[model samples]
Target chain A: MISTASAVIGSRVSVGHRMLALTWLISPLLLLATWALVAASGHYSAQLLIPPADVWHTFKDLLHSGELLEGAAFSLRRLASGFVLGASGGLLFGAALALSKTVEVYCAPMFHVLRQVPSIALIPMFILVFGVEETFKVLLVTKAVFFPVALATSEGIKAIPRSHFEVARLYRLPRYSLLLDVVFPAAAPPILTGLRVGLTRAWMVLVAAELLAADSGLGQMIEMGRQMMRIDVVMVGVITIGLIGFVLDSSLRLLERRLFRWKAIKE
Target chain B: MNASLDQRWLASTSHSPGALQIRELSKHYLLDGQPMEVLKGIDLRVKPGEFVSIVGASGCGKSSLLRLIAGLESDYSGDMQLDGKAITTTSLERGIVFQDHRLFPWKTVAQNIAIALKRSPLTRQEKALRVAEHIRLVNLQGFENAYPHQLSGGMAQRAAIARALITQPKLLLLDEPFGALDALTRISMQRELQRIWVQHRSTMIMVTHDVEEALYLGDRVIVMDARPGRIKYEIDVDLPHPRERHAPRLQELKEILLTELAGSDADK
Candidate 1:
């Protein structure tokens, strides 16, 4: 009876320990404390360094005025459109590059070189051509998203083992089944990783594009805050941007598990 | 006399349609742009509901022979037929299992088995039922939801066998299916395979390096020489299904095969 009872408690202890792991939050708390301490030290001017409470007030003000919502909606709309457009194109282009020798031979070198030219570097040229309109920002995000996803999808398809294709052939699986069941799943992990990278990278690039020239967005709000010397508003925008990136990354990480679950085995 | 008559009755059944006939089959590989003989003048015949095991050295192209019969490659020159139809590109009539259990890691055991029925005419309900039946056929009933990575080597191989047999192919080819297993697992799997053969009575061709295994399970064991693989000889096991493991006939055949194999290697 004692042993059984102890085993029950032992199992519960693991759950209890998981709850206790909230101590991990202390790291972020330490960073906040450091920020507050530096502000209190009065080394920097008031315009440059506003305390955490003032930033919280500015957050509340922005929230109540509906500017935060409007800015977030604008940025997310850009993110969604750019991500969908680029990711689908990347999927098709990557599969083509993997499937056709001629396409690969002709396009692969140029693709590598072009992707190396950062989307941020293209921002000025894009503005000069496309103007400060939404086209410039959205296109910048699309370019940022396209490269990683395409590279990952092509490399993932190439890495599938030859034996698998042979098995598909032996069974005479239909082309649809061969792609959906075998090809897609076989190449999923890397492709999904590429998508997540593309998503986060697009977010960063879009924000930078907005800050450089856009009339509205979290980036524009931050630029306005900087222009008006509202350090507290600038802090709020920075915090919100970091928070959005974290949420996007964490959500995709959740979807990572939804895609496939293969436990690693040594053998 | 009765056993021979029973075998004749089994062979003459029209319901079993896995009869294979091969003649003058030869395969060549371009190693460094020079055509090297992989298989030379190979001839073979298999009756319906028969289990034929081929044992050979590494370079004997036993695996290549299985692949050709599977219709995965057409580079070989041969007159190969299955159930009176010329072997063309891959067809649903043939199935194959490799040394490695090639279960897709992302798919569960049931999904892996069901995918074999992609071209099947069964409805979704029927496919599910067949998947369940095959799971039980391999004694993996509770592990239907388990992924490939969650299974042991032996269990995974059993699942592979289930997947291969689910389509009810005319012929099933196993290329060193149990070679990667441990000694104890290999023995158990051999027993399991024998049981499956006895129950289903499907035509099967297994390629292995183990002489004991070939003699134990096969109705006939064909030995081949390497470096331009050619069938040296074949031995008729002449035993009924589920024979005793320690049968003297099996031991005798093992000795003869061992001697012939070693002598063949020495001639090289």
Candidate 2:
């Protein structure tokens, strides 16, 4: 009886341990096979629905010609610049709002209204204002990134328990250390969630901005491909943008897991 | 070990004033435009190196009294002193361990303990040593890297106790520190606390509802009554440290405290 119970527990543990890796590949592999089969069945024209082989070839050609690599690098550079500017500003502004009632009362309503305006919807307005240049793209992406991070940061700071603040006061923790040690660490999990949301949204906004107007970048590549009726190239750009965004999000999640190991294993 | 009880505590070494003093302390909360009194005209004194446990029925403001002493509540009208200084706000010299282990869930037990020492002037090595010592003092030596959620109820409370003690506070205020623990764990923790009190001999005031616990640990037990809470009775244990679980004197005190709490409940 004891051995049967032990066997049950051991099998459950083994299955649970391997679940993540197994789940990761299962759906994507299934989708790839289904796509390959549907394309082979010739239900749609190749132009309208390229086969997996055609997409793969276009991907290889772009990589070999270094177009894909350089295009992605430029897009990444824009993302990095805009995200840094927006996220940092958002962090500071959010903390200020949390700490000062005047800032909250003054800026909160305006910020709320502004955030409701989609960054994509502002593309034409931004183009007219900034002349379809890199400034327009960066500023649009910044708008996309800023609000979520700021709102999350303020909410995170506010959510910290009164007990922790009392402990901080008892220890005579100074302003700088109080922020660095108590406030930051306590607020970090929620802040990281905010950062993750901001990052994905910014990536989407960058692609959208490039779609509207840009000399280069993955979204521009797709836009140019669409205008010229090079559907395979458009497909390549779409897949690359998606893959990069997925990778960035997954990496942030990895960092969150490492930083909050104590919270992770509990769930 | 027996003689150490009579020896002066190194922390409050010679000529130290009272551990704590409260003079006519009262608190009123504005509830729905009505002034609700919590603590009323309470005067108490705790000598240096003494242990006191407070027991009362629910709503007796026992926890509020501890919070007042720990400087968590400052809006009260009273004179509260620690080491002969006025208590206006929280100070490291006065530490508190709550009923729930308030260790940051993201930090390990060691990190949680070390956080309390961040403002201290101790060196990195000294800080690590003090954390390790306190972890060991709470009998949590092997679980330094364990998170609070990973620990059992008893262990988490012990870690909380360790964090409170790491500062070497002049007075430690505990509000039902073991109230959440299961029966077996509570007994073990009481023994552990007794051992630690014998070793450190710092002034500790614990608020509890357990009759046995108040009798076992306190040098003096203060029983409180509700409806604008004030002390109804005080019992001196007059026993040495590392007290036995089944001491006759403690059992007698337990009956007296149980009667007091029951009597107050009956009145309500």
Best by DockQ: 1
State residue B249's C-alpha deviation in candidate 1, in Å: 1.0
**In order, what lDDT does every prediction score?**
0.89, 0.86
Instruction: Tell me the deviation in Å of residue B246 in model 2.
Output: 1.6
The digit string of per-residue lDDT tens for model 1 on B111-159 reads 9998888888879987887788778778998999999888999999999
Pairs that collide, model 1: none
Judged by DockQ cut-offs, is candidate 2 incorrect, acceptable, medium or high? medium
Error of 1 at A210 (Å): 0.5
Candidate 1 regions off by >4 Å? Answer: A1-20, A265-267, B1-15
Give the fraction of reference interface contacts each candidate recovers: 0.79, 0.65
lDDT of 2 at A18: 93
Q: By summed lDDT, which 10 consecutive residues of candidate 2 chain A come out lowest? A: A258-267
Interface RMSD of 1: 1.3
The weakest ten consecutive residues by lDDT in model 1 chain A span A258-267
DockQ of 2: 0.62
